[model samples]
Target: MQGLVQSVFDKLLPPACPTYTGLLPLITTLLQDRSCFRAALSKGLGLGIVAAAGLIKLPQIVSIVTSRSSAGLSKTTFLVETFGHTYNLAAHVRQGYPPSTYGDFAALLVQNYVLLVLIYAYSGQPALGVSIVVGAVSLLGGMCNSGFPLGLLQTLTAGNVVLVFASRLPQALANYRAGSTGTLSAVTCVGMWLGATARIFTTLTEVDDPSILAGYVAAAVLNGIIAGQVLYYRGIKSRRGTQPSPAKKVQ
Candidate 1:
């Protein structure tokens, strides 16, 4: 197992990469102690899942930026998701979980903020986008210094289960209403579903936190819905293109 992890790391990362530099001793220790190996393996998997979560939104971000159109994207989706990430981070912090466990959520939350702004800007509400960016920065700044209660963090974490589920609804509804999925990347939806599924297993193994598990489950369901939408709409467009128009005579 140690050699497996090391070989995977070596293939994935360059020699000078910090991950390669630091992984040897840790992998060696995991090999020596049976119980320690199991725990460390779980934790390592969990951390990898967390890190992958941070990049799940990249496809969406790229679609919005290079395409310069937030057409099929949902501002509400990212807004609610951002809150979910923030609350999750807060809960983990209150529980005194190692920062590494929650670090990706924090990073992903920032990316979501950028996504929200890009959505607004590309959708022709530049001022609103700018305001949202400023507001988010201010809100984060204020929350950082204020000591948060654990109870509140727990409540927020639990509440996020519902929020995360609802987060994808707006985009799904928009696709339904427009009869198209817009510019929303199918990659983002599929990646999110996969990531959430992986997180559920990793969380159960490593974190064993029910609140977090609940959120991941809810998120996975919604991501599946969005992925379904992507397929459904693609078929709809394809059939439309193939069919003859009513006004035209079939030759």
Candidate 2:
């Protein structure tokens, strides 16, 4: 029994042996610049979260592409997601902050772009058109930021949030109830969760603004919700005594 338990523990945990993993260089850099340690750790954590979320969404993307039907998804969610990322990018530029330093914004940019492509291929012209409009807004948002226009960034950010709560969240909830994601990619959802986790830590460590900190806290809560969904779906898949759905099959 002891031997069996030891074997289970070994299987569950990563090997203790250290290798020249990518994080080693990062750790060395942080050690040299102790002052930046918190920020670096936060960023690294955020990146990991984003990566995890992206991986989780793979099944949904595949399902959508293979089925060529978005029967269970909501168009409004994607619409808002596209705009939200663009606005976030614009907000960063307006603040003279590098998007690369902002995990949420960076992840959102990649996620929204991929979402647009997937929607176009799976859902057809209407979805593609909406994506294009959102993409344009995102581009223009950057331009608006170049001049550091007053109120523009705020307006965009506010609009983006409203759309997310009013449209995206509701649609996501509905999709959850449907037991299928329609055309929405599960990998993207997972990526969003991971990104949110990373962003929370990053924001807490990197930024001093009280408002931004509060926002990061809020994002953490949202990420929790997204992660819960992923887990729930996974549980459902497992309960049926069937093979886990491939990430490609989820789209």
Candidate 3:
């Protein structure tokens, strides 16, 4: 069975594009090759992280859409964080990372932008929501296609570290103030923590980009903080013997 799968992957990927192979299938193949198993494992983990990164924000998006409220979401945080993802996307592209590795950043950016727009729209700022959507698309397009300065790209890449903190701190604080997660998906918080933690190792393995590594490390720490806040707030609610408030009207 393993041999058959390997044969299929080889036929599908071809010699010219070994990097294009799916990570798990590649791992299975690597396990078959004793000499390079460690290296293959590392690369496989990195690819898995890349795939996971694309979905990290999904719970938050779904929570907002289903609840029709961006409660517990910080607009400023998401707006700034979306820029972080945007910068990461452009930086990854500029550095010539394979699409298999970095393409999900594009998907992540788009989804985050959509969430941002939704937040604004829910807040009764439809015009602002539309403007952010347009502005982010335009900026991302220019960054991807145009020959932007290397220094600027580097700066943006490095700035991702700060953005990671900026993104989650407000949300954490909001949770603190509200005394509840308040429509914030516990799944989102926990997933982010786990994902960011895994990203650190996977990044060190595949990307080995200093800025990107720093970004993931900081992101992991911040996400851990947010997860801690969620747990802490949950405890507080339990201690106070208070049940959750009824849902707010969907704006």
Candidate 4:
């Protein structure tokens, strides 16, 4: 019985895993090892964020599909986002970090591509969509290939701080100007903020890569801005809806 229990935990929390590993120490120490415990918790939360990333954008996708319109959606926003995420994903994979540390980049890249295609196709520019996707894939894919330079990847990843700001700024500005978050899913915006914030902790605890850390910090702040816009607009919309309209003129 003891051997079976140890064997299961060994597989579950292998030493190669970038977190608190052995179950016996965790149990015998009564969780008194603060650093180890924090690492374990961070790892768990990182994995949770990764799992949520897989579906985090579905709400926005559904909103656009149901409305049959990509109104208020920014093509530049998604395009730049794809560009940033692709680089981030490539950098992380090449850096050999555990997937838990940067899994959101992969998931978000796919979601952003879908959004770009949908926005283009619905806007009557399917050819442009195909072109952009192919072009981006070819260009970014080639850069990430073998013989690619790590120094360049590091520079690009560091630049993601700027890219993250650019990606979120337009959407937030659009919401401010329109006084509405049209077809933007509150779920997706809020999820982005939460995920970005969580990544900050996980990055600190796990990888501690400066470029990745800076990017997540910027992402958290910027995503918060967009999420705040969503909430503020929603409140305004609700209040307006509740306000009594002027009594209809008596016939």
RMSD of each: 6.2, 12.3, 6.8, 2.8
Ranking by TM-score: 4, 3, 1, 2
**Clash pairs (backbone) in predicted model 3:** none
For candidate 4, lDDT tens digit of each residue in 1-251?
76777666554442433333356665644367566567667878988998999999999999999999999887878988898888787888887877888788878877877888899999999889988888877866776686788788889987878998788889888888998888889999999999999998888888857888898899999899888988888899999999998998888
Per-residue C-alpha lDDT of model 3 across residues 1-251, encoded as one tens digit per residue? 76776676554342323442466756666667554564455555656656776786788888888999987777877788778777778888888765545665776787788887888988999789989889998888888775778679888787777888788788878877877787666776887788777767656655767888888888888889888887887777787787666898998
For candidate 3, give the lDDT of residue 121.
Answer: 83
Candidate no. 2 TM-score: 0.64
- Provide TM-scores for the models: 0.76, 0.64, 0.78, 0.89
Candidate order by decreasing lDDT: 4, 3, 1, 2
User: Model 2 segments beyond 4 Å from truth?
Assistant: 1-34, 43-60, 103-107, 124-148, 158-164, 182-186, 241-251
Question: Would you list the clashing residue pairs of candidate 4?
Answer: none
What global local distance difference test value does model 2 have?
0.57
**What is the C-alpha local distance difference test score of each model?**
0.73, 0.57, 0.74, 0.83
Candidate 1 lDDT over 115-152, as tens digits, reads: 88888877788899878778776655544544656677
Candidate 2 lDDT tens digits, 1-251: 65676565333222222222344553575578654565545555655654554455556667766887666666576666655656666666567653334544545555545555666665567666565766665575565555666476666654543544654476558757877544455565655555655665566565554555555455556546755675676678668777666677465
lDDT (Cα, 0-100) at 190 in candidate 4: 96
